[model samples]
Target chain A: MNRSSQHPLRELAERTRHAGAVLRTRSLETRARVLYEALWALADKKAPSGRHAREALARTTGLSPEMIDWSLAALPIEQARLLMFAERAEDRVPVDLAGVVLAGNVFVAAIEPITAALLLGAPIVVKASSRDDAMPRLFRAAIREQDPELAEALAVVTFPGGDEDKERALFSRAESVVGYGSDHALSELATRLAPGARFFAHGHGVGVAFVVPPDHDADVTTITDALAIDVCAYDQRGCMSPHVVFVEPTEHVSARDFAIQLARAMDRLGQRVPRGPLPPKVASQQLQWRAIGEAQGGLFEGDGFAVALSSGFRLSPGYRNVVVVECTRDRFASAIDSVSRFVRVLAQNGQWVTAPADCRCCAMGEMQRPRFGETRDGIPLHVAFLKET
Target chain B: MSEEHKRRASALIARLAPPHAIPREDAWRARDAHLEALRAFQKAQIPVYGRLSERFGALPVDVLRHARATVHEASEDIRVFLTSGTTQGARGAHPFRDLSLYDQAAKAAAAYALFPDGSLDLCVLAPSEEERPESSLSYMLARFGEWFGERVTIAFREGKLDLAALSGALERAQATGRPLALLGTSFAFVHAEDAFAERGVTFALPDKSRVMQTGGFKGRSREFTPPEMRSLISSRYDVPASFVVSEYGMTELSSQMYELTLRHALNGDRAPIDATRRFFVPDWVRVTAVDPERLQPVAPGEVGILRIEDGANVDSVAALQTADFARVVDGELELLGRDPDAVPRGCSLAIDEVLSAGDGAT
Candidate 1:
């Protein structure tokens, strides 16, 4: 059903409708490959000079062929084994989703669900942001121009900035809207979807790493390397990206020094990471908020104490790898209250656990246990829904 | 004291400051002698910095302290980069300062600027507790509020200025004659001015009611000269333009440049205008009108980029190149405009270009 003389998008829609004609018994692997091929075909093949779309994608997603080869070659079929590991989780729906929406994160990491959906043979409609993950957007184009059959199965388009109208439309046809963003915005967007659309959302999260004192017998290198991954990856943008760090301070590590060390790690990763735009409004707002810090008994200078901070890679006109506050370990959670009580794990004795020894109230806050390592805002993948299904 | 004595005092005080501080330069110390000292110290009392002892070499002082102040003084601290993605892009970096220096400078600047006499009812219309972080405005306001009182009276909603809170603050100030000054950015003042005026409510002026506005309308499209803004304030409130003070400072420098109208002063040009209203450097700040590009001081009255050396940022990066293009007229600093896209311009790129790239990045 590849659009020969007819419109390819329509053909893809029909093909998807036919492929997904069966409500149940769909394969996740089958669904993911079809979606990938479709995206590859739909990519913008002829952009202006030096306007190399692939290069741009590589620059943004940090997924040069080098990284992809590394990923495919080095890593096994080990897919981190999410909650619905080994097999797709089960859920019920009356109809095939008319469209699929993709949220941008680390491209490779963000595409897992798509692969699963292709396995299930679902057509995907991606709404990609220019923030991070440029590779997938480009690859979708490469796949489309290179192969039309795959292109027909996928629809990929990138908007410089997000448009709620387009999102609403995509969400409208979608039997279920899969999104990744903050909880607040996701629920709000869900309200705009067809009255009874399924919404898979990944709300904000703050990844946690423990500051275990390296044992004389322990491999300090292993500890540092593991901890550094939490620091260096995506400049720490994943929902699983570490925001507030809990260093179980000992004679070896001070929380204060650890904060600075984490900041330095981010600094070293600055060139290797993406420092995106901070809206002018955001900068102005920050300055104004900084002005009002007097109300909070805090200062915004690089004191690296109690205040929550943006990462080393930020959109501020002149961003920095700043650990703005030097909060005692006790106040770390409260410092990043904006992200809510999600995705934080205390690092004590070299183990990752959400339980805090001193936190009396629920040991958890007044909030629910949020998607602890969820990166980006609330957006869900159709395949993950299938996985759970 | 004579003018000579005042200048000498300011110079001496500035010199006494240990070349201000630069935190980036201190990063090199992990390979030097102070690494162990820094690690050892933070390992003990300084809880935030002791963790770097393992993978990286240590330093003499806590990294936070060094990052905020000591390293700011290093001229070549490469980490402090100007935003290359444009819009009033200058080689501006938020210089770091140790906890003490930041606090002291916050108190000094706020007190010296607003509460020069005594603590009064202070309210801010700018971003407050809910706003973005690591901003000098937040630091200054927070310090001012704590030293004086948490009297910041603006509420925020949907990440914007709460016009209602501003209105309520004005109404409260008017009902209560306690002298209150409105602190916020020039953009906020400009954006909200008409809204304030249309309500038929002039800013409620307390005894020595004043508008101490920070930030210039550098990137704003609707251009309004300083005098025009002064006029806006003058006509809006029944106060003379002289009562409206414009404070020009950046997060990069601890000192500020101020412009006060001498219109209402009884001792016009005859007696020396009080140093309080004059434009110059504070003891901790040194302002030089340089060729913006070469970093060479321009002749008096010649418009150039304002480069300042502040000892206050001892924990962060030191010297800063401001986005504002300015000139020194009679030892008083007068701003011209923002530097357009140019290399050797802070990040040496155009504002439009930077903004577009940022859009891409976002």
Candidate 2:
């Protein structure tokens, strides 16, 4: 297809390879300039504003635009501040990541690591996810207009997945492969990859919101809104999305009331914005919660609020809507334990202020990833390739 | 419901009728409920609803409210199930406290499906016996057995398919040309097709032949499109693909959706259809076609998430939001596929891919 010529992936990969060299071998001043130039190129393409990227990223990561901007804007600062973490650099560790098999989630994933890849000059073969399709297509169009060589180096192609040969071939050549998928899927992928490769695997981890008894009369709306961040964001598709919301039935907001408010908040968003479907499995799950087998049960769901199945239907890994469950904290924990094989864990309103040790999800570094870079088996990141400050 | 009955017939006979025919008829046209009314067996304490009342309240309407309400007046949502299996899995135990209102859903469908043979020998793809309450397939087969009588078949045990007995039965059925209506899964049927093909036996099912391929398409090699599946079977038999219908089922609701291929739309044979589980959606069902991102419904016909509020399910508050994407065609939902843009993080890519691939939205 001449379309391949219109935006040659070879050229894109080459240019990206060049840019990556600059990113990896060049000084911080050069890195800063390249990022700034990339920004300009992005602007020249007349692609999308940071707001559009922000929204897309938000939809993917579940982080608000404000949060994204704050994060990205703070990226320069995070970089500068992280300059102090020179002590934490893993360059000293003997490691080599032959390539990173990209899974699209958010712009941050592509952009953040590109900085490191460019700086470290690592060869990365990215398999753009459908989410990245829009960004890369637009960006490729932009790059073609401004400069085609850079686009070629990126070699971002959309191949139908399950082409095991392609993936195995790609993984076979790489010393390290980084990717994100559900714990179940990622572990399977890990099995297929070179066993010796240092895997930067992102699978699933359960995210639970623990409601603490706040000292003040906290606005139920406030707690509900906070929980909504993890549920409604990305329509609860991200690993970061809250799967089970643990409320005391007596916390700052009663579990029943919290669920009601949460559902209302989601409804408002759904009506105002209407989140997408629940995850495929979750959608199919449509929790068939029965009180018959429960060790203890009895709770109220406020008007419009319904306690949902923890493992109900997941249409595209999203909530059909919210299912608010009311139970003892231990039961809640146990229930979560039953399903939280590999998922993110969240503590809302500083529930972390109480037994931080009891927090099921603690790898704080996993939090910011709205999409991609998820863990499948809770495998710790023994090393990461960071940009040279 | 099958407890006392299963004792009577060691072999549960699930009469095989296309969902498009039976439930659709019951839901759309049948006057069974109107001419011969059904009173709530338990009123607020329906027997169909068992322990759910403690958390959700009464039967029927309370279960509907459990998932439906405004700010929500229910609590402690629990495990999930598929459509046909829920009531039967746990001994016909409804999620609510009321048990008497056994399917208070007055038959709104009955005219569509013709029960020419009230009792047909049924072949199913579920477990032959009881299993963990969570086994959707097992519960589903049990329900089918309860509904029909003693003519039942199973191909599963310990979460594995029993292929040998299964192949032999299909072989016998096909070779004899026995007037048997096949019921089970699309995948299992496909396998049977291959097995018969290998044996050089033409599975020339009878003219009044019907197959109710349920949701449990487990134990199949690949996901076969309806057209492909039809071709595979039609190669051996003269039956129309229209007779091979898909049964859409979920554990959350005591309802099933069917892909009732048209026998002949020209013949004003539109039967009673379930408003909740339409061959496609009717006006009664409020569907929210979503964009997922702007968190808003897309332009009509544009693909988005499919959310439903069928009053048929409101009795149990089963208003649903799903990640399955679909395109609206003259109000009928053409299930395009799952949205791969976002699946839960770290979920198995293969299972996830299977969910997204052609489970595809248009």
Q: Who wins the TM-score comparison?
A: 2
Error of 1 at A272 (Å): 12
- The reply for model 2, stretches above 4 Å from the true place, is A1-24, A32-77, A82-87, A90-98, A101-107, A134-155, A163-173, A183-197, A218-236, A248-333, A348-389, B1-125, B128-177, B190-210, B216-222, B236-362
TM-score of each: 0.48, 0.60
The number of clashing residue pairs in model 2 is 146
RMSD in Å for all candidates = 14.4, 10.0
What's the residue-level lDDT of A369 in candidate 1? 23
Q: What does DockQ come to for candidate 2?
A: 0.14
DockQ of each: 0.04, 0.14
Best by lDDT: 1
| Candidate 2 positional error at B168, Å | 4.3
**What are the lDDT scores of the predictions, listed in order?**
0.44, 0.44
lDDT of 2 by residue, B1-362 (tens): 31222221111112122343344343423222321111121223233333443332222221332333211122533423323321212122224322112122211111122123454556665555465455444555555555553455666556555667665555666666664556666666666676667788775665555666655333234777656766675565556665556555444443444554433321435543222223544222345565543335678777765655443332243344444566565556656544344442433222233323322110
After superposing candidate 1 on the true structure, give the runs of residues whose Cα lies further than 4 Å from its correct spot. A1-56, A62-91, A98-105, A138-151, A182-192, A211-218, A243-340, A344-389, B1-7, B10-212, B215-246, B249-255, B259-284, B287-362
